[model samples]
Target: MTDVFFYHLQSRPLEAALPQLLEKCLERGWRCAVQSGAPERIEALDQLLWTYDEAAFLPHGTDRQPDPARQPILLTTAESNQNGAAVRFLIDGAAIPDPSAYTRVIHLFDGNDSEALERAREAWRAARAGGHEVAYWQQGADGRWVRR
Candidate 1:
């Protein structure tokens, strides 16, 4: 099954959910990845995941970049239009790298409009309809990751 995560960026800190989510993905032998524009949060997540899972945190891209020998999960930070690669991978419905390649796609958004959220949900559903497993998570009021 393709696992997906959606983290909502709100007034609360959404970064807090990364480590635990990564750990869960690792325990299940699922390839995991995270994308965010928040540098500090991404860095913190990386540190925690690596500290606990030791090589479970990986960095990913659309191009051919080898996974760090140390980590199996991919961590990507959005910059300029660079974040489009991640979005393209999802929107174009191309295959992502493993375990990320396996289908569990997580999308993080800054929650404000329900219509936007609905569109995202639909996109995710399309991915699933194409025969991929998917899941979602978002920043809760308390700043923790919660399923949508």
Candidate 2:
């Protein structure tokens, strides 16, 4: 069964948090695909992964780039898993695909956005109904994730 995790972003913006998650994925030797609801968000994330850290490198490429299948981390607005990723990250209210296709499915939503919260609720129900293992993590006051 796929393990589904919901990350409610409260203390930090997605830009500040995503790179760290992607780094952890890479550390686990998991190829990852980050799917966004809009092309503009994908474009923004593409640039973010490059300059988020001055010393650390998070190797990634957008789906528009050549050889997407070879990238460790792939960013896109599409549903297709071009990189054969072991984990998939859905952001910006992106639609959830079949969760069983990957080892893990992560949904990152803005806590401040009502629509995003509703979408996350819908996703939680869907994931539970689909028989996938589901967990919710909310940011604590200090900005660390606390599973709830």
- Which candidate number maximizes TM-score? 2
Q: Give candidate 1's TM-score.
A: 0.47
How do the residues 51-131 of candidate 2 rate in per-residue lDDT, one tens digit apiece?
998999999999999999999999988899899999999998887569999999999999999999999999999999999
Error of 1 at 104 (Å): 1.8
Error in Å for residue 72 of model 2:
0.3
Every model: Cα RMSD to truth = 7.6, 0.7
Query: 41-145 in candidate 1: lDDT tens per residue?
Result: 556655665465554543432212453323345555532223222221121112233323344565555467575467566666666676665666666567666
Total clashes for model 2: 0
Clashes in candidate 1: how many? Answer: 18
Model 2, C-alpha of 95: deviation from truth (Å): 1.6
Instruction: Tell me which residue pairs clash in candidate 2.
Output: none
